[model samples]
Target chain A: MIEFTIWDILRNLLLAARWTVVLSLVSFLGGGIVGALLLFLRIGGNRLSTAFTKYYVEFFQGTPLLMQLFLAFFGLGLFGINVPAWLAAGIALILWTAAFLTEIWRGSVESVVRGQWEASASLGMGYVQQMRYVILPQALTVAIPPTVGFSVQVVKGTALTSIIGFVELSKAGTVVTNATFQPFTVYGLVALIYFALCWPLSKSSQILERKLNVAHRNH
Target chain B: MSLIEITDVRKSFGQTEVLKGIDLDVKPGEVIAVIGKSGSGKSTLLRCINGLETIDGGSISVAGAQLLPDEAHLKALRLKVGMIFQQFNLFPHLTAGGNVILSQTVVKKTPKREAEAMARKMLERVGLAEKFDAYPDELSGGQQQRVAIARALAMQPIALLCDEVTSALDPELVAEVLAVVRELAAEGMTLLMVTHEMKFARDVCSRVVFMHQGRVHEIGRPEEVFARPKTPELRQFLGVQ
Candidate 1:
């Protein structure tokens, strides 16, 4: 059997970590755009569209991310669409992240008082104009903290993509363990790398919450 | 011709009917005060005229434009009638000037420079010219309400609806808001106020309406209503104060 040095394992995991970071960003940003669209449909749509968006959010939120990745990975093959592992993982994570982001944002929008709606509407502003000028600006400030906080969940969620054979940080740890026979050191280092990626996001969420709330302290 | 015409208007919230069939006409430049105890639906009537609340039956027409549930018509009607709330309801994120400038630019499509100029003038009219750059949270309740007035006035609406505009202010701050409303009445601006300030209403309003159990219990000149008080409900209402 060939011997593996600590540096060899570390280098491989680091290379895999890059994919984790990339997948996290892609899913987060893609989810944000999709979530915003869903928010408009839920907020501004007729009863039919509102109900459609509600169930869409609920279905994704209710399901396991691992199962979704599996469905996107193997389920598409049944329909003659053989998506690559990376594409399947990205699609699954984005859909899952969007479900959470939509609910978080909806809560932020609803927290704006009913008086704000009446006050803006009475100014001769239409619904779209009211949302653009009055509601969204205020809601956005409230949305930032939870949105950033949710990004941590998105980062951690990237680990599940490893199950789909995309070979991110967690999957790389397993591959390194099989060759090096050092499960404890490999998994511990993998956990540390995740903490490094996620800690700043968690801290920044608190910082943003404090900073944004300052504008409304007296309000 | 009357500036606002309400014919057998009705409104309900769930199983509870808030406005039992009511009718009233407000002529140009007339200042009418609607007063009653809580749950009397005085505020509901003002909200209906502004299209903030939908009427269950009958009709309301402002400046010959019917206040309909359709978005285009509601927007058209709102352009003609401005409303002030009891909560002041200034956009907390916007400055006093920004609050006043928003509708002017968005709804009226006034150029930015012209909207700013008009915002300043409206703020000056409400005695808040110095507070143009101040945010709503930074202003006192009285100042905030004045900014709300400025915001409404900048829209150049034909009539103003005040839903207990001074109710949220501290007792000492009430006079400043009333002073602004009093000035508006003096300048021939049509005003429909659901108010509790009896003396100010008597002095400034052209007519007084007493609402009870979601119906107009009595209506007449403030002097006639306060002095004669035809209904016992009105008599009892005026008696408590």
Candidate 2:
């Protein structure tokens, strides 16, 4: 067997970590935009569009992420689109993240009191104006903690992209393990890296939730 | 022509009828107080006038334009009629002046400087000139309601609707809100109010409408309505028997 030191494993894993971070950031931002569009469709009171968004969310959320990645990777091939692993992984992650974020944000928007709508409406504000000036501002505050909390899931979700041969941190671990035959050290360090990334996000989300709750209660 | 005309207006929530065959006319510079026990549909009637609730039967016209459920008509009706709620409903994220400035800038498309000037003037009229920078949660309930009144007044509506505007305040704070309404009445702002304060109704209202079981059970001058209630329902609502 070739000599593989701790430094070798660490260096390769760190390089792979960059792709994981990059994938997580891109999907999260893309998901936010798509999720907002889906939200408007669902709440815009158009029957057919609303139904489309409803099933769209259900399809992505109801199925497993691994299945989604597999479908995105190979399913596009069947259509002769022949997308690369990076594009497939990006597309799957964004769609999946958007599905979850839509429900999360819809709950936040609904949590605003009915009186806010009535009050804004009575002021001659149209639906869009009410949302822009009154409703969304209030909903945004309530949305932050849960939105941040969801990012932790998005970060971990980048791991599943490995099966598609994206060669991120988790996939790099498997390749390294095959070479060194030390699953314990290699996989153990992989989990450690993921932990290091997600722990602060989870902590910050909890902190934000508590802080916002206290601020609201103070009012 | 009257500023507002309601004829045989009816509204129902699911199977429960909240308003049944109501008819009333509000003229310019009239301050009409609508009073009754809980569930009498007084608040619902006030809401319907501003197109907040869609009427199941009959018609409501404000400023000679019929109140329709469509966005254009409702928007037009709301432009001519302003409403204040029991909860005040000031945008919590905005300052008092910001609350008053929003609709003027947005709905009326007034220039920003003009909207700010209008906001300042209205806030001062409501005795909240000093509170222009305060957020809803930072103010007392009474102060918030005054800002709501300012917000409505900034629209320059032909009439105002008060849905128990003082109901949410502490007893001490109630006087401040009623004072603003009193000033509005004194200035001849056509007003329709749903209230439980009998004294304020008798003192400040041009007419008192006693609603019972979703109909106007009694309607007349405040003195006539309060002193000589013709219906037993009104009498019992007045706690006279």
Measured by TM-score, the strongest candidate is: 1
Candidate 1 displacement at residue A66 in angstroms: 1.2
TM-score for each prediction?
Answer: 0.98, 0.96
Could you give candidate 2's per-residue lDDT for residues A50-131 as a string of tens digits? 8999999999989999999999999989989988999999999999999999999999999989889999999999999999
Model 2 regions more than 4 Å off: none
The worst-scoring run of ten residues by lDDT in candidate 1 chain B lies at B232-241
Model 1 agreement with the true structure over B1-241: per-residue lDDT tens digits: 8999999999999999999999999999999999999999999999999899999999999998898999999999999999999999999999999999998999889999999999999999998889999998999999999999999999999999999999889999999999999999999999999999999989999999999999998999999998898888888989943
Computed on C-alpha atoms, the DockQ of candidate 1 is 0.83
Error of 1 at B239 (Å): 2.0
Clashing pairs in 1: none
Complex DockQ per candidate: 0.83, 0.71
Tens-digit per-residue lDDT, B1-241, candidate 2:
7889999999999999999999999999999999988999999999999888889999999988789899999999999999999988888888999999999999999999999999999999988899999878789889999999999999999899999988888999999889989999999999999998999999999999989899998899999998988888888888886
